[model samples]
Target chain A: MKAFDYARATDLSDAIGASGCLIAGGTNLLDLMKLEVETPSALVDITRIGLNEIVPEGDGLRIGALVTNAACAADPAVRRGWPLLSRAILAGASPQLRNKATTAGNLCQRTRCSYFMDNRSACNKRQPGSGCAAIGGINRNHAILGTSDACIATYPGDMAVALAALGAQVEIEGPGGTRHIPVADFHRLPGEDPSRDNVLEVGEVITAVLLPAPVEARQIYRKVRDRASYAFALVSVAAVLRMQDGAIAQAKLAFGGVAHKPWIDPRVDSLLVGETPSKALFDKAADLLLEGAEGQGGNDFKIPLARRTLAAVLAEATAE
Target chain B: MAQSPAARIAVNGVTYEFDGDVRRSLLDFLRRDLGLTGTKKGCDHGQCGACTVMVNGRRINSCLSLAVMHDGDEVTTIEGLGAADNLSALQKAFVSHDGFQCGYCTPGQICSAAAMMEEIREGWPSFASEDVAGRVHLDDEEIRERMSGNLCRCGAYANILTAIKEVMESGAKP
Candidate 1:
């Protein structure tokens, strides 16, 4: 941790126009700073700006970006309406970290790739154009889908996967004005420019995450990790299904730890919409979801692991 | 934003004013500046709960937060839990149950356990809770899931579980 100036934001404008990285929970950012992976000249503390509200907005819930993961998970509305989101948040971090980690910070969390975190390694995500060490080094936990030759870092978040499955929208405020970005498009695939994780411009602050009306369906979030707790996901699944007359009426599937973004493909749901909920149908849907997934040598197992995890989630969700 | 002046913080019941680097973590501040080395630094990251402490009635990893971020906030570390001659009930329980072998991660484990019990009393739901809306029953599985952050290298999990069970059964308030 290097010497840096710190300023506590008093209002939205103070946080919006800050010249350095915004600090809410300071869980991930501070760790990166300690590793010298993230060296911000200034730290703008936004925890006191009063963005921790979780209120009803229009037909759904609008979660303030500064809401701590613990509070968001324990909110009655979230627990009843969006159990998948709550479960996902709890599954991601331990109780202590969840108390300090914020919703915006979780969504903005960097990759957990060992190469990217280690400054000694040549990681394009850490230093643009340097080189991608994960492409040739130990990449058992790297991304398998939506990866490019430049980088293969995986997005390490559980809440974001559920958010992407629920069709959540992110609210951002910048120098220009406020705007809304769908959660699916918020993160970008690893392309030539793997340095940029999301589409946020300079001096842009995420205000709130808008979750659409809760669907009347069975929701489940299953995360498989190396250990029972406090470890990043190997491959997680968030499945929501609406069953009618022993048939799948609607479905939504999102995967984590397999891609640069929350891998959500509507094609699988479309294929299962009018079909009977069975192991055969789920296997077919899983196969369709992993159609073009290419894997590094060490991470080749993730393709089949993700497919089986998706199938299990679908089975549990559509179970009577 | 130039270098700010010395920040003031309240740990336990004492107020301390120190001129330290803003980038220094709360764990470093307590250990280096205040000489409160009871709180260990196992990983220096949020992954390990060796730096756990109570801030505004909630438990958080001090290593995950900068020292200046806690200015004017009420903090309670392991040193604040009890005096050497007068150990807290939870501490006494840990000793009786032999909850630790190396004792390196004891302070944080106790502090986290104290706060975790309060969270359960307030109807906070955990990922493994059977009934989200029902009372949080104190069981081995629940305690293990809640205390998963605090890793004991000596592997004293069975005794740690016994200590927490004693405290919970005694109906002690944090």
Candidate 2:
């Protein structure tokens, strides 16, 4: 859309220190730029930075930032070890999009809120101090769990939800140094400034995502959307469970399309940790997770929808 | 501002070097500069797959990718798939099945299906695949799910499905 300088970076240090917006895959950023929603003076292409490897680290796997969504999902080790990640990725976007979209790009993608994308609408996420139009207008797809007076935009990604359930960590490289941020704490709630999606500071770049050792659990990623395919989730659930002696030994749950970030609550997992599989127990866990979830006018159905989806996923996962 | 570097990309085995505007999309470059207008521009966003093209052997929305980002990459557009005299197998199937009405989305559909067949051969699973780790079976559901990116506004999906099924059943390399 706007004329800007572009250059490819082959070295990690060059990419990290470049004074330009990082562009990988360019699925989301370029779309926003076309709409004049995102205007950068220059772009530093990181596709050639050699961050595209998916290798084994310790007992787990380290996925490079430049790995495409399709490559990551189709990897043999990923499909066998972390099926939830594979399933979650395949659930989102179309085949063509997954082919070009990168791992870190998906994590850093902006919300699909119409107001945020439409420069005409009053969106605090787009322009701070402006009013949020989705708060009271066409909010059926807005966030219900992490709503603020300023914004209610959903994170709009399925892979992050699975990663949150897997307890993955995001590796960051910046001018200061290299550090890791847990996926759960990476995305921020739209407290007052919704402009910043994640916790990355200025000039910081996501290098890779470190997945902890795969757990011995039955994993499933179930997404409910307006259509069967090529649509964003209305409400999605990622569940990881381990059964021992007919009792739940471990339970991890993360919800998508319901919050500003992948919604995860430890209380729900604690409730189902040692409990035997039952509809009643699953309902309680769902209730605890949906507690205090206030929905906007059009999205009130998501509350019950999320509850039923969560219960169904838990039931299906625990079913013999 | 500093001048951007030149981008060299190969389309249909022909390499071309250009020093164009950094904001130029791959779709625009193919249509306007190269005069390869077989690729259509529907939404100009990633939502519509009208601009679908293969970059480095993978289908991607050309409208969403900057041409400058494709330096040293090989691209295959509808024009490169096959000429009118020598149509690709998928293209021939489309003609026999009447898989299009306006034919605006046909190029994207064929290009996408061509690459999709490769994905199936590689056992890359789709959302419709029951077993993500198991061998892929090309059922009607898998074809529909994989082709959901290309939108045929003329409601010709039934014919499109039939055309793709014919190619798949014939075991022809699309």
Candidate 3:
């Protein structure tokens, strides 16, 4: 809780124009600040910049970055159009945390890796080249896919997983200008540097998240946690499927708690297209989805758990 | 005094102007600056709902938010809900149902339940809600799912559930 100069941003320019870190809800930022994991010299409050609106764009919805998780989940348009987003967000945090967490902050959230949070531990994500303790230490909740020797942390947010499946686009404003990034490509894997979670450049302020037109598909977000609520996902699935005349018309799949980012593969959907929903088909697709999955010592259950979760989510989405 | 930045906030209808450290959380602001100790701080984090408070008609973990961030926002703590003489319906229900064995987490639980009830009234859906657009009925599963954030180590969940149900049935709002 070291003293940091605080300022309020009045507009989009003022927000991104400043040189300090932008804070909206302060749910995740403050936690890291208290843990000393993030110690910015200055903080720019962006909540007052009037970014809380949820508006309609071209055949889609544009959610302002400041909109709280609770508001996003309860929004009538979101519930009707992108029900998977609502369910995914609700699956992550409690009611109180949801009330304070914002859509943009959720997407920009850091991993819940215990080593990264502990300053004493040698975490490459927290301090590059220090070494990753989770690789040798307890790694039960570590990533199973897209992991490198540098870090094994998992992207813990549930909303991003659904957004990745729905093909959502992020609207960002920075010193360069405004740009849109696909949700699938927003987060990065641990190749050489695990410190960087997303492709957000420095001083880039997220403006809104644009979700495409309603997919007339059965959307489902199934999360398996150790506890019934208020727990991180052991392995989760966000799936959207459209069935036409006993055949699959369109399919979108994203897996969470299994990789450095929300695991989304177009081939899973392509493999299922024009095919009827069945256990065998789902099992085959599940195997294909976990093809390159490699579990650490303690997280071996995630392989089978992720497979079952994918199959179960597919079955639930296609259930008559 | 460190002469830190000052923020303005209205608590339970009374506006208070106080100087707060930039790093001080809303929970500390209410407890230390304004002396509103009724809102207990358990974990000093968002995990435990013991620091729950109502901010602009919504329940939030006060410990997770900085005091300077909530400037001009209306906050309501447990003390605002009821008094010793005039107990709110939920307070009365808690008393009758024995909603608590140890009263440390009572304030937070009550505040959370109040805001949760309001959320349900406004058609807000919980994770357990079968239909998002359908009417929110106060059922056992719904109540449990909605109140799952507030933990009670005393194992008074049954009584807490009963108290919340009674208050809901009695149509309570604060």
Candidate 4:
């Protein structure tokens, strides 16, 4: 890794001004620095600021961005109230990884595109307008739902999918002021501007993530990946359903590893309301969500794979 | 090479203050700076668990963390567990069951195993967690699931599990 100045900041704004990038736990940033994927002029260590609290605020949780994935997953409040998120975090890399990885850093981590991995390869996210190689290149794991001509790389983590499904919100301090962005709106789709991933403007530091009050629903995070553990999902679904007398009262379905943002289908979810949740209803909702999935030749398999994942998760939501 | 960055690191009750680069990893600080060479580094990427260590009780990938970030924090490396004279139960069990070959990944594997036992004790669970909110039982499946992070390319998982099982049963300092 290239040489850089490091100092622990006393406050959030001070950290933003002292360094080019904020070092939460140094899990993702240090790896990239070693690989030369990320080379900041200076690193502001934010571990000392005590942003690691996971407390109940009003009816919801105010999860400090610095909370380790392990702590957040292990917290009693999270285990019972938000099992979807807990399971999603657990289904991630491994026990060791969850310790060093912070909630804010997990959301802020860059894409995992193979082309992006190789700096020599043309990746729009790595070098804006350099040209997207994953579009025509080997894209078995590339996105099919949210993409433009610029980028096709998918969001790699599973925790964010559950967060989006649970209606989480991110609190950030930027040049403008402290703003709370809805988790769904925080991450942008690859519409016209593919370079901009999160809506945070320049020099914005995330303070904490506020999870909205847990829904009175049966929630499950169903992830389908090649490996048994420590692997990214192929297509994962975070489903939360409230069934009233064999009929759906309300539902929230969001997908991961298939789109730029959480692939939510509230319309298809609406169909589940006031209806019995059978394989047929789940299949219909799965079909509706897959309508926007335009696959590259190599990733054409994901079109059906994603639908089945969603269907399976929806079915799981209906069961005891 | 750049100038070393300065931070206070307390590992296994030993305190250290050194100037190390911001980019230098916590693994490097432990092995190179403090000379606690028991910890190992396998894959520099986040894939392998060879560089595992404890920061304030929770186990994390040391390769992924910068040394200077952990100021005023208690860290525990493999060397902290036990030594030749007074070996931890897990260490002795490893010797009894022959849990290692090549042995490069032993330090990391041992450290990871130690922390996972604590995680289970606290009722923290995994994907296969039977009751999401209920008490988590640490069965074979639970052990395998929790210890999945540490990789022994030599395929000594069975012996490793045996060693851990002995330590859990014996209730020693491993």
Q: Best-fitting candidate, measured by TM-score? A: 2
CA shift of A227, model 2, Å? 0.8
Model 2 CA deviation exceeding 4 Å by range? B1-3
- Candidate 3, which segments miss by more than 4 Å at Cα? B1-5
User: lDDT per prediction?
Assistant: 0.89, 0.92, 0.89, 0.83
Model 1 over residues A204-295: C-alpha lDDT tens digits? Answer: 99999999999998888999989987889989999888999999998988899999989888888899998997788888998889899998
- State residue A98's C-alpha deviation in candidate 3, in Å: 1.0
On a 0 to 1 TM-score scale, where does candidate 4 land against the true structure?
A: 0.96
Q: Per-residue alpha-carbon lDDT of model 2 for A1-320, expressed as tens digits?
A: 77777877877887776788989999999999999999998898888888898999999999999999999999999998999999999999999999999999999999999999999999999999999999889999998897899999999999999999999999999999999998988999998999989999988889999999999999899999999999999999999899899899999999999988998999999999989999899888878888889989999999999999998998888887
Q: Which segments of candidate 4 are over 4 A away from where they belong?
A: A16-19, B1-5
Name the docking class for model 4.
medium
TM-score between model 2 and native: 0.98
B147 Cα displacement, candidate 1 (Å): 0.3
Chain A TM-score, each candidate:
0.98, 0.99, 0.98, 0.96
Q: Which candidate do you rate higher for lDDT, 1 or 2? A: 2
Assess the local accuracy of residue B87 in candidate 2 as a C-alpha lDDT between 0 and 100: 96
Over 4 Å off, model 1: B1-6, B131-135
Name the candidate, 1 or 4, with the larger lDDT value. 1
Better of 2 and 3 by lDDT: 2
Model 4 global lDDT (CA atoms, 0 to 1): 0.83
Clashing pairs in 3: none
The backbone clash count of each candidate, in order, is 0, 0, 0, 5
lDDT of 2 at A281: 93
